[model samples]
Target: MRKVGVLVSGRGSNLQAIMDRIADGYLPLEIAVVISDKSDAYALERAQKAGIKAAAIERKACASKDDFEAKINAALTDAGCELVVLAGFMRILSANFVNKWHHKIINIHPALLPSFPGLHGQGQAVAYGVKFSGCTVHFVDEGTDSGPIILQKVVPVMDDDTEDTLADRILVQEHIAMPEALKLWAEDKLVINGRKVKVLA
Candidate 1:
């Protein structure tokens, strides 16, 4: 089985989803470690509860962004992680760090990407008055949410939808989509061609 390292910065709902899938024997992989940039992030607590090795590498301790990511890379490497999943990780990674991982890193965004790229993606979609908004799982590229799209699930935007409501719905889809994407990757079924991902049957 492939080993996964999860990076998180906040509540880690997606991280929880992956853990649930693993526990239920739905995902064919092991969570080797969970790393967070914030010392006080709830994700760390979640990792501990799941009995996964967890660490907090505060970005403030590093002299530069590269240094921080280097430490993160070392931590993941030490854990024997083959895949890195970014579940609400807030930092913008440097080019060197991104290149080192290349297609090995995956991230889930709250909105159908190429639409709302950065933070508050659900709010951005709601404000823009989109009828359909959802979540996307993609390979992490140098640009913000600009990597090859792996999977996407569209959720209808209700008339009374607030940012929180929309995000909640998208989060459900993320829970499903993220694990599916990871499964595909773990099985060596995902092929990246330029900006697209081809899933081999």
Candidate 2:
């Protein structure tokens, strides 16, 4: 089984999804560690409850972004993590860090990317009045949410939907799509050709 490292900054609902999948034997991956930028992030508690290694390397405490990333990298390396998953991690990684990991890192976004790339994706969609909105799981690159798409699950935008309501709906799909994308990666079924991700059957 491949070992994965998860990075989180908030409540970690997505992290919980991955763990649930692992426990149910739906995903053939080991969660080697969970690291959070916030010491008080509940994700750490969830990891501890699962008997998984958990750490918090507060970015504010580090002298520089590089230092913060170095600590994170060391933690991942120590735990023998082969892949990195960003589960609601709020930091914008440096280009150097993204390059170091390259295609080894993946992230789940609340919006069908190449659309609402930054924060408040659901809000962006609602404000833009789009008929369809959804979630996306893709490789992490230097650019914001511009990586090759791996998997996407679409949810329709309702006329009376607010950001919170739309986000809640998309969140359900996010929980499903993130694990599916990771499963593909673990099974060696993901092929990255330039800007595209081809899934092999």
Candidate 3:
């Protein structure tokens, strides 16, 4: 079984999705560890409920940002995690930390990407009046949500949608998209060429 480490900062809806897929035998993944920068994160609770190992490492407790990442790196390594998944992890990992994972890390972003790459992606799309808004599951790189896209699911932006409503709809797609990305990744069906990701048969 392939082992992965998941990082989360907020509610772990995506993480729950991955766990659900794995439980159903739709994914060949074992969650080695779930780490959160916040002690009170609901993600940790989800992890514990699934009987998965959970670690909460506060950033302020570390000597520096590098030190913080170092501790996380150590945890992943100790757990024998081959891949890292960022499920709403808010921290921007250091360049060195990203380089260590290289193409082994993946993140789920709440937008089509390269459009509204930062936070509040749902709000950005709503404010921009776009007809379509969705989610992207991509490899993690040194850039902020600028990595090669692995899979994307587009959700139509409703005219009568608030941020909460749109995000709720997007979350449904996220649950589907994230599992697909993880399946492809574990099966070695994704190839990163430059900025593009190719899914092979």
Candidate 4:
């Protein structure tokens, strides 16, 4: 089984979804470690409950973003993680770090990426008035949410939908899509070519 590491900056509902899948033997992967930038993040608590190693590598503690990411890389490497999943990790990784991990790192974005790449994705979608908005799982690259897409699940954007309501809907799709992306990666079924991701049948 492939070992995976998760990075989170908040309550980690996505992280919890992954753990639930692992516990139920639905995914052929193991969560080796969980790292958070925030010391008070509830993701750490969830990791501990599952008997997984957890750490808080506060960005403020490090001298720079490079230093902070270096610490995170060390923690993941030490845990023997082969895959890194960014659940709600709030920081933008440096190019050096992105190159190091390459396609080994994956993230789930709230908006159907390429539409709303950065922060407040749900709000972006609502403001843009897109009828269909959802989540995307993609490989991490140098650019923000510009990597090769692995999977996406569309959710209808209702006329009366608030940002919070739309975000909640997309989050459910994130839970399902993230794990499916991981499974494809673990099974060596994803092929990244140029800007696209091809799943081998």
Each prediction's TM-score versus the true structure:
0.97, 0.99, 0.98, 0.98
Give one digit per residue, the lDDT tens place, for model 3 in 90-196: 99998899999999999998999988898899999999999999999999899999999998999999998888889999999999999999999999899899999
Task: Single out the weakest 10-residue window by summed lDDT for candidate 1.
Answer: 93-102
Over the stretch 71-112, how does candidate 4's per-residue lDDT look in tens digits?
Answer: 999999999999889999999999999898978899999988
- lDDT for 37 in candidate 2 is 99
TM-score of predicted structure 4: 0.98
- Prediction 3 TM-score vs. true: 0.98
Name the runs in model 3 displaced over 4 angstroms: none
Please identify model 2 stretches exceeding 4 Å from their true place.
none
What's the true lDDT of residue 176 in model 4? Answer: 94
Model 3, residue 5: C-alpha shift (Å): 0.2
Q: Which residue runs of candidate 1 sit more than 4 Å off their true CA positions?
A: none
lDDT of 1 at 114: 91
Best by TM-score: 2
Query: Roughly what TM-score does model 1 have, to 2 decimal places?
Result: 0.97
Give the per-residue lDDT of model 2 (tens digit) for 1-201: 899999999998999999999999999999999999999999999999999999999988999999999999999999999999999999999999989899999999889889999999999999999999999999999999999999999999999999999999999999999999989999999999999999999
Candidate 1 residue pairs that clash: none
Query: Of 1 and 2, which scores higher on TM-score?
Result: 2
